[model samples]
Target chain A: MTGVRLYFRYLGVSFRSQLQYPASFIMMTVGHLVVTAIEFFGLWALFDRFGSLGDWALAEVALFYGMVHVAFAIAEAAARGFDVLHRHVRTGDFDRILLRPRSTVLQVMGLEFQLMRIGRFTQGFVVLIWGISKVGIVWTLPKYLLMALSILGGCFLFVGLFVLQAVLSFWSVDSLEVVNLTTYGGVETAKVPIAIYKGWFRRFFTWIIPLATINYFPLMAVLDHQDPLNTPLWLSWLSPFFGIAFFTMSLQVWKMGLKYYHSTGS
Target chain B: MAQIVVRDLTKVFKVAHRKAGVWQAIKGLVKREYNPVRALDGVSFEVGRGELVGYLGPNGAGKSTTVKILSGILVPDSGLCKIINRIPWQERAAHVQDIGVVFGQRSQLWWDLPVMDSFELLRDIYRLGPVDFNDTLEELVETLNLSAFLGVPVRQLSLGQRMRCELTASLLHRPKLLFLDEPTIGLDAVSKLVVRDFIKRLNKEHGTTILLTTHDMDDVEALCHRVMIIGRGQILMEGKLKDIRQRFARERRFIVELGNRYVEEEVKGRISKAELIYLEGNQAHFNFDPTIVTPAELLHELSAEFEVRDVLIENPPIDEVIARLYEELAI
Candidate 1:
């Protein structure tokens, strides 16, 4: 069987086991939806009071929020194993993974499939549709394609961050708060327009971490809006590729960490 | 030909040194000391195909470290090691495809999933086809008697039951080589026997090369034909079980139960070339070399002097032999 088929099999087993506790599953899913909804409502109230933040309006900011959450939800669900990799490392379950015949990354990816994250995704989906309706952007085949690519790129970016966090477990089993600062902090920061942040913070997100590549730049291309910070339109369209690049780079770091684990026996 | 050959395999670990107290902890954050521990110091051994070799050692004697390196989960700092003609750490995926490992302390089975579900997932992980998987699964289930709790979740099962399922899970792939790291640890007599029996059959029937690392002497006596003793990160002794017994079996024990109360003078006068190791009201224990005086002569001498009501002649227990060996080697 192909790796993809095997991954789905893992997903099937994981989901079935999780479903064994129907009450807990339902409660967690609803709780996740409620918490995320409250967060969005807080943003909605801020937009209601301010009307517009500089050049960005409520709908434009909603587009950014929706894209980031949707991508984050999908990545968090699919890459749930990497998100909690410290537990596996600390408990020595990672040794079992190394014993398998499959690729470590693929096996780790298949370790979990958080079905409850569907609640978060659903909220993001509803908000995205509402934002599209309110923004009044004319729908076209190319525009829709760009939007799909942007969402996928955003998912890859978050997954990359998760993979990086997991790789750190090889060196230290403690779950560092710094990684959360980047991952959770990235999502909260990216939900707002990049132009509103300080110049250094904006540049850091753009060049170092590339959080803007998935949301801000792709949104600019989709909305046909000029960059408020005066960047080229073509560069904005290329932002989605940065997500793929970041993901690929993170994988190399993961490989190095695996090598370190093998030699050090940590 | 040997199925596994490890020569001069050495691994040194840099363990961080952490001192107690808030000031030391603060200092550790800035600059920490690392002490080098030689987990495997030029260890070397070999196991032929279809051979059940017992790898024995006391705690921190590098038994688990050797198993990890042999199974490809760890890489040695120096020396050559090969399993089935493949360098384990170099071609780990391919090497591990034909190998299975079980760590007694850790469960590879899913905690919340049924035993059957974990088996099915393992089937998929190993990519076994439907017909072949069914055939192998049926044989393992029947042999290991996993039908009773196949539907039960692993967390709910008893330790013995979970261990049986764990054994079955590892063999579903029908790996040519199996590494059992203390497979019978913390098991009752019945569960230990069941596991040992299954492992014996698996080795005989499937011709799987089995390397068992265990602290349980009974496990070694029951399952292994050949035994390797390791001490201080090195192979101290490697030979057949019978050879070890013969090497350490020079002294024999005799327990003679006297009809009347024990007499020290009578016991001393009759038993020559034998030291009375222990004495009670009516029973006396003697340690004597069989070569010096045969059991018949010793029995005759004791009976002729003292009114011996019963005589029990036995060899020392395997644990004593192992303990003595460890002490002598200063491991």
Candidate 2:
């Protein structure tokens, strides 16, 4: 509880610092909104031509897009410490964090609050609510709870990916573009049903990175659609569990990276 | 029992040697070689609680490596080290709770946040109770004269102001031991004096044990009670600053201005003992060993022989003294 409280305080500091530059904050937020909107429009155009993507309707895809972006935005806002890890490494600012009498993970998570992501978050919420209304799905309390859990799970998974990217900075200072393919590309690929992808691609993301567990399987249960792959009904609902498991494993990697930091001297 | 102890603390770093040019860079990925660089070689030291020790060294002399190991930032390959009955690397988080570190090259204050906000954040990080937090904050703010800059963002403050805030941030938890690495680097004369006075006060008032590292000789002279000079990952000299100066003290130079320039064949006693090093523009530099010839006696005899206007004594630089020590020790 104390850790969470202190993290909130760090977030509060970050938010206030961001608010100091109102104009820049608003401009970046708007830019985020436009960029995300354009990506969604490309999906909408694809649906217009094909009418649906491998048994997935536009509303279904919107549901996936909205949830992934929402989770991603939350992670981006909170895990920006990891996002700018290179700057901290180069400037020896990480030394300051180490000197503090707090968990380094919490301190880094609270490193920065990108207020500009509010724009992407706001747009995601609008798309999510619209998709739910248009899909005409039966809403039960458990299903609603599952939806919330799925978002949380997705947020944790995305944050894990961010953590992994940040840890790689210890070895190489330059941020690689391949990591973005996993994060940004993961989001793009998850929007559609995993069935749309080839056998190799689907297996890679599902088994290796586990991107499919956040959206595809959970959406299947919510939509009451029978999956051709014959994954058990209980297993489909357990998609979020995989995300939590992966996050726990990534925590070990983060610890190893920290030990490396001490040895190398940042 | 030693509050801090170390034996044969050696740290060897494997650094990948990279060649210049794009083609060489491409080739490096396929074939790379790493060379071992020993930053600390069997270097050892011990300090009792509440003792303020100044660590001095030239650049890349492994001064920081020692500080890092003691502060639990790095682990030596082979060494027995402890701080307050705890191994620093093994019990890093616990060991660091009672220790504060400040790197003069870096600032701990939040760049975009006010100084007060940074302090409040630190209070939370340390999990200090409201009473203790407020007391320490008040004391630091008052002693450091930080009330004026409390509301200002760190980026907006001057270097001196930022440094004060940094010191306050590090000390918010009231660590028993403080490690200051080049804490006075780049400060102006006034700021340096204020910092030195504050450190002295911090030591005397709270009995905060301090270990400082610096290249500035004045910092050693003004603040350090005991100085340890290290070079090539080894201690070259360690003793009282005044005592070390006496050991390597050179002949003092005296520049005399004559009322009138005269081609004197010889001065009575002055020419006999002193080396008249330079003579130009009605002035001369006399290098005289104070042990051999008293400066007063030489000045009086020289005045009797020639008209004298003014005289000034020059103390050679402490850097020269340290350089000579390095040559003698081959460190």
Candidate 3:
């Protein structure tokens, strides 16, 4: 109970701090909204011109885009400290975090709750609800639960990616751009249906990175059809678990990186 | 048992040697080389409760490294360090609950928020109860003179005010031990005095054991009862301030002024061994080796020979003594 209350207090302080510069906060929020909207607009233009990708329709693509953005926004808003770990490490601010009585993970999570991402969050949410209304399918309770879980799972997955990115700073600070190929690049690539991609790429996203679990499997479940690749019916429901597992594994890696950091004094 | 103890602590860092240029970065990834830098090599120290000890060393001399290890921020590669009966790294969360740390170069206070907000965040971070938190807050605000700046954003506060707030934030939980690394660096003389004075009062009143690492010798002299000189990852000397000076500065400085400006003449006997540090016409300053002669005898000899007007004696600067001690010990 105390821990939960403390977490809320941490968020409250972060919100107040960000609010100190209301104009900058508003500008950044709108900028994120505009920036994220461009990607969806590009997708909409492509669909309007060609009509569909393979057999996937506009609403199906929206589902993929909406779900992934929701996950990314949550992680971007809630786990921003991990995204900016390099700054903290370079400035030796991470040392102060260690001095605190709280766990480093919890403390870093509480480092910021970027209200700026709300711009992107609201945009993604609007697109999702719009897609839901336009699809015009019978919505069942289990499918609804799976939809919610998919978003939750996606949140953990991206957070895990952010954690991995943060862990790399413990060693070398250079080539951080390469790690971005996995995170921002992953989000960009995951926007499309997994079926349109080649076999190896599909396998990589499905079994390796598990991008399909967050979107395609749940989408297939919602569409009430068996996936052509014969991935088990239950597997789509487990998409969120991939993210959780990946995040847990990344946390382990993060701990190992911390140990290495202590030994190396970096 | 000591409140803090370390046995043969050592920390070695492997620095990756990276090649320059885009092409080199690509090639270097496949075949990288690493060089090892030993930061702390077989270092040892022990501190008792309520003892304000100064940990001094030159830049890159492992001063901050030692403080980091003791405070549980970093782990030593090969050694045993126990603070307050706990291994700092192994049980970090528990270990840090009773320890407060301040890095003067950085402000732990939230940069954009008011100082009071930072304090409240710290209260939550440490999970102090309402009554205890209020009590500590009220006492700290009054003693540290933070009322004028508490409501102001940390970014707007002057360096001195920010430092005072930092001190209050760190002490709100009332930890048993406080680790201050360069807590007075880059502050005005008044601010430095305020920080030093507050530290003195805190130590005197609360009996909080403090291990202060600083480049400022005055802070050491003013606050620390004992000083430890470290260099090259080793303890060179640790003792009372007076005792360390006596060991290094074996001479006493003597200043003399004549009734009138006159041609300088060489003095014989005890004053000859004394080095002439300064000479302005009739007024001359000589630093005599105390082992060979005493201040009284030297003054008597100088008074008897020359038509002296006034005389004054002083000790060498502690910084010079410490420098010489470091050289002598090869620390």
What local lDDT score does residue B131 receive in model 1, on the 0 to 100 scale? 95
Poorest 10 consecutive residues by lDDT, candidate 1 chain A: A169-178
**TM-score of chain A, all candidates:** 0.97, 0.96, 0.96
> Compared with the true structure, what per-residue lDDT tens digits does model 3 show for residues B49-119?
99999998888889888989998888888988998899998888898889988889988999988888898
Give lDDT per model, in order: 0.89, 0.84, 0.85
Q: Score the docking of each candidate (DockQ).
A: 0.79, 0.62, 0.75
Candidate 1, B1-331: lDDT as tens digits:
9999999999999999988999998787678799999999999888999999999999999998998898898999999999999999899888888898999999999999888889888888888889989999899889888898899999999999988888888888889999999888899999999999999999998999999999899899999989999988999998988778768767888998998886677677767868898888999988889888888888888777778899898988889888888888899
For model 2, give the TM-score of chain B. 0.91
Question: Candidate 3 lDDT, tens digit per residue, A88-157?
Answer: 8888888888888787888888887898888878888888888888877898898889989999998998
How good is the docking of model 3, by CAPRI class?
medium
CA deviation > 4 Å runs, candidate 1? B263-272
Q: Which numbered prediction scores highest in lDDT against the true structure?
A: 1
Highest-scoring model, DockQ: 1
- In terms of lDDT, the poorest run of 10 residues in model 3 chain A is A223-232
Error of 1 at A70 (Å): 0.1
- TM-score chain B for all models: 0.97, 0.91, 0.93
